[model samples]
Each structure stands twice: as C-alpha cells, then as structure tokens.
Target: MFFDARKNHQRLIRRAVSAALASVLIPLAANPAQAASYIRVNLIGYQSTLSAEAYLMTTSSISGETFAIKNASGSTVATGNVSATSGKWGSYNVYPISFTLSTPGSYHISVSGTVSANSPPFSVNTTSNLYSQGVANALSFYQNERDGANYISSALRTAPGHLNDANATVYKTPAFDSNDNITSSLSATGATIDASGGWWDAGDYLKFVQTHSYVVALMLVGIRDFPAQMGASSNSDFTNEAKFGLDWLQKMWDDNSETLYYQVGIGTDFTNANYQSDHDIWRLPQADDTYGGSDSTYQYIRHRPVFVAGSAGSKISPNLAGRLAADFALCYYVFKNTDTSYANQCLRSAEHIFDLANTSPGTLLTVAPNDFYPETEWRDDMELGATELYFALQSGGLPSGLPHTDPSYYLQQAATWAHNYITGPNDGSDTLNLYDVSGLAHFDLYRAITLAGNPSGLAVTQSDLLSDIANQIQTSVSQSKDPFGTPWAWGSSDTVSHEAGLSIMAREYYSLTKTGSYATDARRWMANVLGANPWGLSFIVGDGSLFPYCMQHQVANIVGSTNGMSPILSGAVVEGPTNAASSGSLDGMVTCPPNGEDSYKAFNGSGAVYKDNVQSYSTDEPAIDLTATSFLMFSWQIAGAPATTP
Candidate 1:
C-alpha cells in the first residue's frame, strides 16, 4: 500500500533538519540517525460530543515540524503543527492543538519529523477507545437484560386483574334494548358492558388495560407465553372460548416493542408518529380528529400526558400512568411465567421507562381526574403517578423504599378492593380474598390464564374460583332478554366493555375448575360476536365489519379469542365505518344490504381500531370468533356464507 505522510514525520523532519543544519549538514546519503519523540494526547467528553489533543516531540532539535493524526483504520485524518512555541535557534519546538471526536469509535496517532537532511524517522502508535466506562457499564447492564436467561423466562405471570376498581362509580350498570342496543338488553352477561357511550367504558377500559398489560409483557419478554401448539392455529381459533386464547398476543407485543423504542426518539402519541397500519389506528382511514374533544357534553375534558425527559411541552401530567401501569404489570407477569432468561429483559425495559420518568426535567407526581380526558385537564397533569411508577417499581423485583407503602400492602389492598367491588357486591358474599387486588386477583388471574393449567403461585386455587364465575356468567348470558322481547340475541344495547369482564369471568371459571359451562359461556359470547358471517369477507371486514360501532363492545367481543378455536381460522375482521343511518345499501333499494357504519370510527375513533386490525398477529391475544369459526368447520361453514354447509 502507498504510504501517506504523518504529522509527526513532517514535524520531526522540519525540526531535526533545522537543528542539524545549525551544526553541520550530513552528506546527501548519510546514514539515518535514530531519535525519539514524545507525543501528548488529551481526551474531552461533552454532553453532545468529545474532543482530543495529540502532538509529537523529539529529544534532538529539528528544523521544522509536520504531524498528521489518523483514526483506527490508519487513514490520514488530520495534520497540524507539533509545537506551540518556537526556539530562537530552532533547537526545540512545541505544537498544541485540540480536535473533536463526537461519536464512539477508535483512532490512532502517527508522528513523523526530520532532525536533519538525513535525520532518522521514528514512530510510536497510540490508540483511542472512545466510549467511556460509565456509558459502557450502563449499556452492558441493558444488554444483559436483553439476552440473559432469567430475562427471557420471566414474562408469563404478572398481569393485573383489578386495576380500576377504585373508579367504579363511573361504570353504569348494563342495560340494553330490543334492537340489540345498550338500552334494554344489556346485562352483565348478555349485553355489551360499556353501553354508557363514554370514551372509556368500564368493560372496554378493562379490556384495554388488560390487553395493554398483556402486550407490554410480551414486549419486555421477547417471547410468547403459551406453547407453540396453543398459539393461533387459525383465524377463528383466536376466539375467547379456547382454553389458551393468546394468539394475537404476539403481534400486539411486537407492535409495542417497535413503538416504545421509536417513542424514545420521536416521542409518543396517537398522532404525529410514523405508525404503520397495524401499529396505529389513529391515522387509519376510519380515524377522525376527536383526540382533544370533550366527553359527551360540550365542556372540554381534561388532557394531560406523562412525558420523558427533555420533552418540549408540559411535563407535569401523569397521563401515561395508566398505560405504564398496564405495561409494567404485563412485564412482571411475563417475567414470572416464562423461562428465567426474561428477568433481565424485564428489568431493562422497566429501567429505561423509569429513567425517562425520573430524569425528565420538571417531573411531578400525581394524576388528576382530567388527565385521562386530555382536553381541558391536559395542563394539570402530574408525574410519577400511580400505576406507572408504582407498578413499574414492583416489576423490577419490587425495589424497596417506595414512596407510599410496601408492594405487599398494595397487593393486599388491590385484592380487597376486587372482592368488595366485583365479587362481593355481585355475589352477596365476602368469602373471597378481598385484600389482594394487585398481588392476588390481578396478579393471580394473569398467571392462571397464561399457565394453561401449570401449577404455580395462586394458579391452582384460582382455577376453582374461575369455574364458579364461569357458571354465573353463563347464567347471566342465558337470562339476558331484550325489553322488546328478543331471545338468543346479543348486544341490543352498547355494553361492549362487559364482553372483556365476562371473558375474564369465564376464563377464571373454566381455568380454575375446567367446568364445561364456564367454557360454554365463553364460547357463546365469542360466537355471538362472530355471528353468521365468520370471516372478513362478510363479517368484520366488509358489510358487518362496522356492524357494532361501540369500541368497548367490540373490544369485549374480541379480547380473549386468540387460540384453540375452530370457527375463526382466518382471523378477526377489520371493523370500519358503515352507513347505518341509511336504510338502503349500494343499490339504494328496499332489498339492498344494510350499509353498516365504520365500527372503527363509531367509538369516536379511539385507538381500538389498532387493536382490532392487529389482533390476528398478536401472540398472546386471541383471534376473533369469526376467524376461529373456520377451524371449527365441523360445526360451521367455512365460507361463512349464511349457514347450511356444515
């Protein structure tokens, strides 16, 4: 290879020549003499960049000096003066200069100079390792969590069951009408649970949080909770009736994993992100600009958001706490259920979120009522609020010194609330463990659902409770009748949220005891949602896609149907807007097909569309009953073209 001149070489030659000439000039071809040069280099680290200094020096005086610096690849990066001061007789010279090296990389220094016409050439090599030990240590900690065995294995058992029990006053009792609307037919079991027409219906809200937790767990663990066999076998298999309804769970996990990282750089929000169709429903064709709108009344709903450090806008909002709470609980559950390898991964994910929350400038703690509204209350948000920070701390091995109290106490409190609010009031008995919401009900249910009969923690005991709940849920479903007198019909009213709660009830009922009725109701609920049109062609994607405009209703119907079913082998249909307001179809005749409204837009364009669209690929989430119906070809027609084939 051709050689490029270095800074030290030129400097040595200049200085050595000057000094040697002062005494005598060697013959044109005199033997080369040996000389040594000392070079000093300094490193500087800045918040955004770095700098370094290098120079060459020789024992004997030289005429002039030239020096060049090179990076690790030996490329001539720069050449500059070797001396800051010059000697009167040119016997000694010094060059001091500083340069920058912003990114992390290695570099080398080469020096060249001449003492006389025939001065000897001397060289020494220096290398730079740009990354600091502290940064490296932190990065290593992150990597350990990513690849460690404990990290991979721990994501199976840490979801929360009773998150919003304290806020139950807002949940209106179920009521539905004859038209399968929210007014007359809505029962805890028969109708959709979130018929109140609120942005966050109780049932839909529960499903969203549960789904969020499930998705977060998968994101942190980087693996599936159920065995491969139990994963989505077909589209309809994603229905809730299946014992292991965790098919779409993986896709949801991937969506979260990809988005959270992107959020770190570009920031988080339903809007203003490069979200793909599956990643975000906010930007979908069915979406609208309702994000900052008021609830039902014209008055503006509060809007607050939790933000990472360096976020440009207000940093006081605890808006992201609910979302974070869901994520942390999922992370904990996944870490607990999976192999040990997931522990470190869980820690890493939690740590990054925590760091962002803690180091963020102007951090505050507490979540106001309007934080969820994001309209009027957006300005009053706090930081380090409940759910996000509290559960996040617990996920990372329950770090001590929490502000409010110990995790055990919180868990007990959660359990007590769950019993008092849900099981106690409804069942007319206080026999259940009412003091274990965080650690027992939410936590235990998460574990039991994923374990698929594996015994661990409270799983074995919870199975029995699940069976009883399933029986009651079925009874409720069977007793459900519309005020207008319709039988065997679902959703006369808009209680979509109840679908999820019921699924959980049914799951608990069957999972704990393996009771057939518990599973039967679960199956019935899923079947009702799928309807005669079991595939996207007629059901969720096309005519019936926008069939039910309630998001909470949709979420409830679809939440737990991801595996081990047969009817929905293809997957859930994509619910879009429809022309339900009109009585005519494309032909505009009395015989025209019903012009369904876009289901995606009906719930005022909540992010529910994102979940419905991506549920098929989610590993832990269940596939819709429509898709599962295909797998159960023995019972239902494959084409889903109005019965008879089976």
Candidate 2:
C-alpha cells in the first residue's frame, strides 16, 4: 500500500512565548457529511520543550469574530482575541494562542466564528484521543487471544498444504550489493525496516494457535474461504511450491537480512493456483496485477527465481525445508503459550534451524553474517537458539541426544546474564544495570521461567518485575503529555517511537501474573496510544511497510467488495476519535504505541494509565495474530484467572 500527501500527513511542536507572534495556519478541510478533519502537528522532530503561536480558521472570511481551541474533550485550552484586522481572503483569525499538553491524553481543537448569514453554519469537524482508544481495543483483542479466545475466527485458517495469504507478502527481499553479500530490500515503497512494514511472515503460527481454540469455527470458515481449487489442485504443486519457498528461505538465510531471517517477507508458494504461476505471484487481497517476476536481477532484487522454484519443486534443501513449521512455532510462542503436539513439531524444527543457525547447512559450526545475532552481542544465536529449545522443552519434546541439563544450563546462564544487568552492582550505581530499553533483553527472563518447569520458581519475583516495568511505562505516558495532556510518542528517545512492542510486553506481563497494575497499565497504554484515536476507532496497518509519517496505515474506509471480504490480514481498521460516545479523542490517525516504554517505565517506576474503547474492522475484525492473542485471553477467562493490582 502507498500514500500521497493529502492522503496521509501530519506534524507538531511546542514552546512558551510572552509576546504575540504570527499565527500559523491550522490547514484543515472536511467533507460535507460525516468526515474527520484536523490540523496535524509534526512533533516527531520537535525539541522536547518549546511553545509557539497556534491558530484555527473557522470562517470563510476574515471578520470580527473569535474562535477557540479546546482539548478533544471540549475543554477550552486556549481562546483567541480577534483584532479588527482583515486576514487572508477566506480565512478567519483565531490567533497567537499558546497551548501545551506536557502530560498524557488527547488534545482536540475546534474553531467557531460568526459568519455572514448566507455563509456555512459555524461548525468545525475534528476529534482527538482516538489513538489511545484504538490501541486499547487492539490490546483487549490481544489479551483475549493471549487468554484463549479466538478473536480471529479459525474459519480463515489456510489448509495444511498451501501458503496462507496472511503470511505471503515479502516484507524484505534478498538482493546483492556490489559485494554479493546479499543485501536486503525493505520494500519498494522505500520503507527499509520491517518496523515500517514488509517481511513479517511469522504470523502463520499465530493463526495456528487461534485455530486450536476456534477449531469448529475455523474449520467452517476455512471450508467457506479456501478455494475449491485448493482441494482439487495437484498434490505435486504443494511439494513444488514448498520447495520454492524453501529456496527463497535459504537465500534469506544466506543473506544477513535482519539479526534473524525471521521468516519475514512475502512467501511464494505454488501449491495453490492463486500463487502457482511460473512466477512468484504476489497477490494482495484487493489489488490486481500480482508483483514478482521471472527475471534474475533488477533495480531491486527479483522473485522470479522463487516463482520458477515453486513451479519446479527443485530448489529447497530437505533439512531446511522441513524446519519451517517449527520456526513458526518458536516465533509464535515468544508471546503465546503452546501445546504438546505443536511443541514436538516445533522442537524438531528448532533443533535443525539452530544447527543451521550455528553451522552452514551441511557444514560445521561456523559464524557467518546471517547468524541471528552477532557473536559479540551479549546474547547471540547460541543463547537465542537455546531459548527456542527451551520453549520446545517446555512443550514436552526432548530431542534425541541433546541433554535436558544442557538447556537447563543455558537457561541458568541466560538468567545470570540478565540478573547481573538488573542487579546493577557492577556499575556501582544504585540503579538497576538494566535501566534502558536495552533491558528489554530481560524479556528472556520469561523464557527462563518457562524452562524452569516450576512456574513457581521465579513466578512471584517475575510478577514484581513486570509490575515495576509497567509502572515505568505509566510514568512515561504521564509525562509524555505537553502541559495540556496529549501523549507524545516518546519523551526523550527516537527509537521508542511506537507502543506496539510495549503493549505486547504489558499484555505478556498480565498473561503471566494476571496480577499487579499490569492489566491496568496495559489497558491505559492501549487507551491513550493505540485505542484513543479521535474517532474512537482502531486500525491495523498491514504487515507491509509503515509510511514515513510514522502513523500506522489508516484505512479511509473498509473494503465493500467480496475481494475485501477474503480473510486477508493486511491494513489496519482505524476509528475516528471524536465520536461523542467515546470518552475522548487523540491527536493522530490510528493510535500507535510508544516504542521504548519498557526502558523508560523501568527507569521512572511508572507507566501510562489504562483506558479504551472498542474498534471495528470488516467482518474479519482482528487479524490472525490478534485473534490468536484473543484466544489466549479467552483461555485465561475460562480458567478464571485473578488480576494483579499494584
């Protein structure tokens, strides 16, 4: 998906001013009917503190009238004193006013002016705080999956053999720089990081988890959604596509795409007719003219080989090809719990991938550029690979010869590394060594607990740790507001831009302990960040690249066609924040999470509050991943879990 300026753009900055200054235009417009309109302020690159002149144009003609700017809740934050001076041709003056949010919440502005009797009525259409609301809904959906309710119906599950369209887009493509070291393409859209979108293929296992809970519903949906052609397709096509997919995976492995190849990027599978042409047919749900070609090298890397490989079933390595399923499980369990059968399959698969990670396939242990982590990194592929093994161990599949003690030792060692950092004694400082988001490394502690077998071993301590982290995140959210109460993406760091990761972390915390302020904080962050869009709606930007504006992809409207109804998980469902029914509105499009709450919240001993509203997508509301998380939540509900109150 792509966007043009008017289609998607916004900005902001703040500071103090004693004297009157030139008012900046709050460029805005709206459709005659129910449509949202607002002036976007770009604060992403703004300095931490500063205030400036702000204005709102309410009338078609400059005249002796005043307009006011209010917080999204309709509280007057600033009022304009009109000078009897004619302004621009068709703009009313609401000028030289100052406002600040220096806290967390949504800031909404409305301008009213006394206009000529023949002119349009005095009305300004806008809303705020919807971002937070949207996020809360997304989080709630996630919590449900984490607890064990299938929010995404299993009816959408891809039958066992073909590539699920949900996980079929290539986020990043394997290419070669002048050196032939295998460079990667983020996406043709120019987003070079997976965070922006493109190349996130691990969603497959997430659907699998959701399916288990909503088996009947999923089976039914699958029967309706899966094409009859898939059932009638030649069985050989499945094998062929599988092989092609493997070769593509191998190329990715050979290339240092990210720290891990991560099963990211669009998939090329020929088992089904939709994707089985002589080329790697990249089909999105609604768009026509599938991407990918048979050409070897182009301005960007090419997927033609993948297409050819799919048709021939000649390119995949048996060992690597066979391991894809397990890899999927490892990725899913990072946040989700798993069952025995899935665990066994994942274990066998992980063992092989670990081997492949450590050694070139068919070769001895040798470090390479593509290894998931660098040898120099505190925890490299060895520890990380072991971590996957640990999950597999918990799932009940013990590998043939690998001693249980070995994994145990690795977990212990990982704990030691984490403990050393958290204890902070080495730095001779009173603060925990793991004070920054770098401390996110501590997430591994959860992995260790899973491996410890005695969920009680570090359970109590872990709950405390999570609470402590949640508090810090809350504090960050609180301070993020300018003096008025609008939450900024981050207070001091650029890296901690979105709260998606934090939401995931907080939800995970709640899942583990169901105790403390975790749920409250999780809900709060969701409310303020992702859920509280001005229209009180939420959206899912597809797994493609995030645009330059930093906002998630905000769909103008839901698809109204059968093509739109297909069970595809791309694009976010965005809600406007200004709905009167909503508690409030947020400042941006669909709300997104601030990136580094884990680090900031840890240092501050506080996090944002929990608040939220509901959201709507097509009949296919939450994507597979979101639905899987909902299932997890439902599971917890069924068990009647207790909540953690700090």
Candidate 3:
C-alpha cells in the first residue's frame, strides 16, 4: 500500500498546464474482430455547467468526424467535431470527446460519420439530481451495512441485525493460517461488553475498528464540512448516521479503564472444519441472533467474540489512537453548540486517547489477520488526530473533566507530525482513503496555521504542507494509464475515490491559491467512478443503468437480483479490476455468473478485468471503507465544489 512519491515542482503554486495534458493510448496487439462502434459515457447525470466527456470507440480510425448531443426526443442540442482520435483501446480505435449542455434534461451522445454509433441515454441535470441522489444512495448503503437494533426502512433489509452484539463476549486474537483463516479454538477473557451498533466492515459480518474508525471519521468530517448538504440532525441524515458510528466507537473505547477493543467476530475457520466463523456462514445478518443450529458450530456466529487491541491502560497503536481521537474531536466540533454534554464526553475521550499515542511506533494494528488490511504507516493518522484536536481546542471551551492545556501545544504537535509526514518516506505514498488521511490533515493544518496567526515555532510551513497534497494529485495524474484519465493499479477502484478526495482537498484551498487544475481532476475521477471507462461500467452500484448487480455483499446477494434493479445495493462502491478474479461461494447463497462465465472477458485489458459476479470479491465486494469517500465526494459536488475558476 506504499507509493514512490513521483517528484514534482516544489511548490503547489506552479501552473500544472503539463500535468493536465495527457497522451493517447495505442493497444499495439489489440484484437480487430469487432467492427461496430460503441459510445462509452457516464450513465448517471452530469452537472450542466461542467463539460461532459465520453469515448467513441470503433474498429477503424478515421478523420472528419462530428458528434452531437441529442435530447430524449431525438433533437440535436449540442454538436462538436472529433478532430483528434485518441489512439486505441482494446480492439477499438478511441476518440476522446467532450460536450456541454446547460439545459437540464435527459440526453444521449451520437456520432454522425462512417463509424456511427449512439451512446446510452444520459442526463444533463442540476447538481442535486446529479449528486444528492448519489449521496442519499450512499447513505442507504451505510444503513444496509448497519448492525444492531437501529435500522433503516429498506425494500430488502427490514429486520435489525446482530442485536446480540450487545453484551458480546471478549476473546483473545486467535492464530491464523496462511490463507488468513483461524487455525484453532479461541480463548475467552471471561468478560463481556456492549459492542453493538456499528457497521459490518464489508461483505462479511465481521467488524473491525481498523476499518470502522476510518468510516466514522469520514462521516463526521462530511457532517462538519457540508452541514447544509448533510441535512438536519433530526432526520435520518449524516449527523444521525455519524453519531450512530460514534456511539459504537464510544463503546469500543472504554474511557474509564482506558481499554480499546478493536475487533468483533472471527474470520474463516477452515483448519477445524467443525468450527465455523463469520466468513464460513453466508446468510442475512439478522439470522445470527436467531440461528437454529448446534451451539458448538454457530456459537461464534450467534454470540460473536470481541478482540481488544491491548490490555487496559496500555499504549495504543498510533493508527487507531490517532483516528479514534480525531473521530471524537470532530464530534466535539459538530455537537458543541446543540449537545454540550455529549460534545464534552467526545472531547474528553479525544484528550485521553491522543495522550496515549505511541509516538515511536513499530507494528501498526490494522486487523487481527494483518494480511486483510496491511496498513503500513502511522504518522499520517497521528497528524490528523493532532490537527483535529487542535481544531476542537481552537473552537472554544475545554471538556470539564480534563486539566487545562493550551491549544497551541496541539497546533505545534500537528505541525511537527505534518513535517514528519512530508519528509518521511511515505510523504507522497497515498491520498485520502482509509489508509492515508494526509490529504485531509494537510488541508486543515494549512488553514490552522493562519488561524494561529502564523506561529513561528511550527515544524512545517503552509507552503510545504500544501505541496504535499499537490504531490499526491500530481502522482496520480502522472501515473494515470486508463483511457478515462484515471490511474490504474491492482485493487485500484477505491484508489479512484482516494484520488478524487485529493483533488477535492486541493479545490478546498482554491480561495487561498486560486488554482483550477484540481477541479478538473475532481470531475475526471468522478466520471471514472460513475461510468466512463473501457468496460462502460459504473464502479458504484445503483448509480447508473449499467452497474454491478451481483455484489459479494450478503444482503445484496441474498435478496438482490442479477438484473441490477431488484432492490439493488444502492450507492455501494466496490473494488474494481485487479486483472484477476478470486471466485468464491458458500452454501445457501444465490449463484452468480451461473457457470463461472467471464461475461466481460472480451473487454479485459492489461490491468483492468472487471466482473459483476457475487463470487468475484476483486470486482464486486462492497465495503464500508471503500464507500466512505464517495459520501464526501458526492456531497462536495452537490454543493458545487464552490471555487470554479481556472
């Protein structure tokens, strides 16, 4: 999960005219069997103000080609010439094209030439129609991912799940086999705690604080940044959903005893076939509490086991401590005015936990089976924790339970950590996904320096910190190999979400710097996720006509249809093509792909091979961490992303 920070200009103020330009891709040995033309586009609506882009792919290359945007009634609304062909993609010659339509209505892309074809019907709509629905659908994904008594009204998911997580048993982390399955029986700690009301980490029922805390922070940050877009706290909106995760996090963090429980339930247990684990069972989540089977086999499923990070009062892995602290500190900001008592509790937890960060860290704690998450760095996590703590302290009063400490102390700490992150080996390693939060931390710290009247003792200057985020975008842009202008790598679909966040962070600094390169990046990444790609598929479910129907999620796979609309897992973003598929299945589950057929194999390329099958976790598994970024990205767009000047 590390990157070789591609070197770029030392300053973010440098014009990225060259970074914005891209070259054509010619598939040298691409097949030439298909003769017809195909138009690839974003099936979901685009913002009327932004120039919508698509790809015209055919078997033959040509000149003097013109394209038109036609309304639902087949009337021409906009026209442009495809003067420059964009080389080759798969077996087709590609022509990159763009058009603008200010009018809000349904439309389609059309080419009037020798190689003529029509794109799937799309829309040019308002930001609300284009993004708000996406955000709402994303929230539905979270709700469907929800655990315990509080539940949302969904067509497929009606019952509450994992209610028995309340008063869940505590267990020691078990040893795992090479395949990441538990090898033997687990030992209980002779204790119990209420560990209910969080999200299921992914397609599986097991929950991990490693993934949960990251989701909680993103939700809280969205609630803080886009208060208007998130809606009222009274409704089942972002504030309510974030608070749901926060409440669960509070349960995980035993403040009185300084204990941090990091995981719940066990993974696959193939070593002892008699014993079962979360992955070994593939049923709706609600069935666990009411399971009808031998207690010895289903005990782990019905009464899940919780795993603590370490013993009470022990120093925590900086990764967990930092994010846990940030989650609460942001909670203090979001609720300080309306809910003073709750905000104080959040701030108090933040103060106590941030104080216990393992500054000189070794092995970072991600999941019990480290192979599952494989998080490498910790400084980025701590930097965000300190910066948000500083923000909470900068806002106003201290939590009543804690001793008095100056806000400047945290500000300097944040700066020092930011400096470490910038100079550290992982400086430009990643963007704002669950693993790397430096993109977000840098954005806040830059402004926090000014709020503190440009403190002289800080370790990093505003210029150094801002350039780091710019470098992340620079790296992604430079590394882009996809015909859609997105960088591709193994397990890179979520990386698109991360890169989109980096661009949005750069845009958040626009009023201060007045640059627009990141704005274009923001749109480009969104397009890739929404649908514009070689396969003409949307990585996010329920966003467009053509999206994943057989996601590996239990709820979706059990009750959902293969047709993409029988109560689809709306707004769930999945991991995309890693050029390989890991096909799998369990008993009593709907069979996806019917006979292991590779439906889209003809379109497979060097690093991109996407499958919409329940067995394919590589291309179909939707997880909490994977979908977290989409919530923020969609909200930012729904709010117009504000500064649009280039």
Candidate 4:
C-alpha cells in the first residue's frame, strides 16, 4: 500500500529524460514508424472497479492486442484484451480494458506485443481517500494564490518558488473611471483600504465580487453537505480556505456606508505594459498608487472603486447585491457555531444588503463592463441570495426588526426565481448552457422543502428538480462531441464547471432516490476531469501522471518554469479544452502559437484545441468559482451516500 515518494519522483524524472531523448534522437522522417510502434495508457492507473483505457497510435488497425496489470511484486494480477472503443484523435485508437483489484496497493500495466509500453506505477484503493487528498490539494491552491502578507508554509507549498506578494496595502485614488474617462477632483488622501488579500480572479490581479461571491457560496454548501469530508471544524482546511475569501469579502464591504466594491484593480486590457510590469516586482499593493497626481503613468495605475446603493453611477443592482447578501449570509451560517461575534456581524451585513436588493429593483448593476466577470443575469443570483438568507435566518435565530427574515417571503422569492430561470423554456441547449448558478438555487430550495422541513406551496418540487438534473446529465452525455464523452465548447472551463455542478446535484439525487446510475455518471465525469481524455492529461494540476504546468495565471507564469515541471500551484484546475475558434484571439496575445491550436503543427495530429500557455486565458486560466465547485464535487464524492438512506 505504501511506496517511497522519492522513488516515484525519481521515476518521473527518468521518464521525462527518456521522453526528451526520444524526441531528439528520433528523426522527423521516422515519425510514422515511431507512432506505429508505441502504445500509451491514458491514465497512470485505474481504481479497482473502473475501466482502464490504453491508446494505440497507428494508421492501420491491429487486432487481438492484449494488456496486463502487474502488482508491485512483479506478478500479473489481471489481464484483458484491448477492445477498440473510439478513434477521433488522429491515428490513435482507444481500447478500453477492464480489470479489478480486490486489494489496495501499487501496480503497473503493460501491453503485450512488439509495440508494448509499460505504464508508471499507480495505486488502487477501496476507500474514497483520493477525493480527500484532492480537496486538500485544491485548498492548497488557494494558499498558493494568496496575495498580501500571507505565505504558504513549506509543508503545504507545492511550488516553492511562489513566494508571498509583499504588497499588502492598497490605497485607492481613482484617476480614470471604468470607461477610461478622467475623474474630476480625485482625492489625494484617497481611501486607504487594506485590500491585501483575496485570490486573483483569473490570470490577473483583479478581484471580482461577482465570481468571488459564487465561489464562497459553493464552498459553504460543500462544507454543509459533507462536513466530515470537508473537515468542517474551525481549523480545518475547508474552513481556512473559506475564511480567506470571507476576509476579503468583508473588507470589500464598507459597513458604515452600506456599499460594496465590485472589483479591485484593472486588467490587461487597461494597459498591457503596466499589467506586465507587475511581474518579477516584489512591492506592496500600495506601491501602485499615484497620490492624486495627474501624471499619465499614474493614471494607468490600478483603482479600487465602491458601489453605493442608489448613487448616480452606483445604483444598486439586484443580482450583484443578491450575490453579496448570499455570500455574507452563508458565511454567517458557516461560522456561527465557531465565532459568534464574527457570525453576527456577517448576518447584520447580509440583512442590510438583502433589504437593499429587495427594495431597489431595476436593471442589474451597470457600474462597469469588464469582460472578465460580467453579470449578464441576476435572477439566479437573486434566488441564491434569498435561499441562503432564509437558511441562515432559520439556523442562526432570526434577528429582530428585519424584513428579510420572513421565511415565506424568501421561499416564494427563491421559487419564483427558479421557475423563471431553470424550469423555464429558455434554459438554452446543453452546450450553450455552460455555467448555471440557478441549479444551486433550485437545490437549496429543494433541500429547504424536504431536508429543512420548511413549508411552501411553490410549483417546483423535489421530484421536479431531481428529474431536471437527471435530464441535464443525459443531455450532456448525448451532446458530447469529444471522444472522451464529456461536453465541451468555446470555453471549456464552463464545461468543467457544469460537470462539477452536475456531479454535486447527482450526489444529492442519489441520496434521495438511491439511484446507482447517478453515482456512476458522477464518477465518470470526475474521471474525465482527472485523466480520461484524448490528451491523457488531468485538467487538475499535480494530481495525475500528465497535468497542466504552464497555467495562464500571472503569478504562476512569473514564478513557475515553462517545461510543465512546476505548475502555477498544485490542485488548480485550469480553464479546459476549447474549440478551434478560440485560437484567433489567443494567437494575438502570445509570441508563439498556443499549444492546442488546430493550425499548430504538433496539435494537427492530435485534434486538440485546448492550450496551457500563459496567453491562452480562455482555456488555461484558473478561476475561483471553478475551484469552489470542483471542491464541492470532490467533497461529495468522498462523502459518498449514507449506508441506509431515508
């Protein structure tokens, strides 16, 4: 069951060296011969019950190929014939081979014949402990992405070169508005906010409230559903990670003025040179400020703008406010048992924001339009916020003198929101409907009606929600265009998020119906995210044999090496595979062609259009919401269903 970590590391090194040497020594003219002579198993290994897949690269079909799985003791424990499944990726034919391991231990696999290759040793275990390990690594990614004075401890740091950002203090003196217009009479002694914390939104230093709130809400839900799996104590990894975001969210809110800052700092589109200049610089967050100077260089500096309710440019957006309210309310519920005072503060803010959102309804927040995190729809956010607020009030003793505490009001609001978005006719197609937060709202309402024992005569019932989820899963599988059997589109991370979200829902459905297929499909999606793809690479970094290294994150790009040895940070899932249409935008950003372009010579044979380059933000940038949802999915998998469900 145990193997020396050092030996495994050494084996990886040897394989890398051998692969490099093979690439150099083998002539380009002999590519066809080399391709025809080797076989590759997509995964490092497989679980006891899962099917193992091996890929044979050849232009011509070969029959009767056999493969064997050997134990660490060099004994063949299982063997099977290679049955061709699909061959969409160039000349490679995928053969799915099945095997079972009753015991938990390390093992290697080999294909029989003249063109055989041995897989590196992998493990098989009965317990869902891999999911736990994955959660830990995913949480560690937040630590690695931490800005300000926080430094990841040596024990937890996967990429040691990624040091803490020295800049913690951020003094905001806005020179230009969101439209690049100069602001008249900008303050010299601007609001000195300690915007030292929060994970970067994606591939940039900007911290967005829209995306951050969604992530925080999902993390809370994960802990609530799988307390044991998520280690729901105060000092636990899940709680710690949630706290990092909570602290940042709290800082973003100015309680005295009842205003929330949607985002901090500008993105690359503002000024490419200034954005790139932050690289390799060890300075405080305050160093970017210009102290009300009219200099052009100072004008290009970052700005931290706040949105006040009913203000000229800051008219309250129901969705943005709803998201903020939900985030705070969930934080209140999660931390109430551990830190009462802090929890009360969160509840107060939640109520204030909820009231503001409910009272003022027009168009969503029109403060700024940053393509990075646009708030296109607000109904989902509104439903999620209402649902969370209802739950928080139900659990944390409804506070006196609060209109938002009416359980019937919130329940009806949530149900109406769900009806408008999810159960409506315009829910969109499977591929087009990438990331839907409305599902979470539906799930919450369903739980309220059944699990929480709340009373509401809403048209949306528990059975209806479950049926919709099942249909969505079926649609995803039926609509997938890839050989890997997972749906993908222009933005692959949306597919990744959708899968993770579906997995979370499937687990809940399994709990209600005791349906085995739900769990089976969930596991299949997880497998695809881990390794079961045409590229044979895990989208999650640092987990599988082949994973992302050159993530499009700015900090990671500056700190990590280029050869895919050191990832931006371990356990971070990048924006996954995109279609060929994305190549044009990516090509304009980087000097070299991004890795997965169809026109790229290397990818021509593989049919892969997803890239891991730093400039390929559409595909390779890691985002907070995706990480949060992925954490939820992994936690649900590890928790599994109760032995005897009601």
Alpha-carbon lDDT, every model: 0.25, 0.27, 0.75, 0.56
Model 3, residue 284: C-alpha shift (Å) = 1.0
Regions of candidate 3 where Cα sits further than 4 Å from its true position: 2-34, 233-236, 270-273, 488-493, 509-512, 594-597, 641-646
Task: Put the candidates in lDDT order, highest first.
Answer: 3, 4, 2, 1
Regions more than 4 Å wrong, model 1: 1-225, 229-323, 332-414, 423-479, 482-504, 532-539, 542-646
Local lDDT at 370 for model 4:
28
**Number of the top-ranking candidate, with lDDT as the measure:** 3
Model 2 regions lying over 4 Å from their true place? 1-345, 351-388, 394-397, 403-407, 420-475, 482-497, 507-518, 529-537, 541-646
In candidate 3, which residue pairs clash? Answer: none
Each model's total of backbone clashes: 175, 135, 0, 2
Q: How accurate is candidate 1 locally (lDDT)?
A: 0.25
Give the per-residue lDDT digits (tens) of candidate 4, residues 424-535. Answer: 5435333111135665676677776664464547856677666666665666666565554444332233545666666676676776688667776666666667765544
Could you tell which candidate, 3 or 4, scores higher by lDDT? 3
Per-residue accuracy of model 1 over 457-506 as CA lDDT, tens digit each = 42123444344344445445555432111112222211221332343344
Name the 10 consecutive residues with the lowest summed lDDT in model 4. Answer: 5-14
What lDDT is reached at residue 216 by model 3?
A: 86
- The model with the greater lDDT, 2 or 3, is 3
Q: Any idea what lDDT model 2 has?
A: 0.27
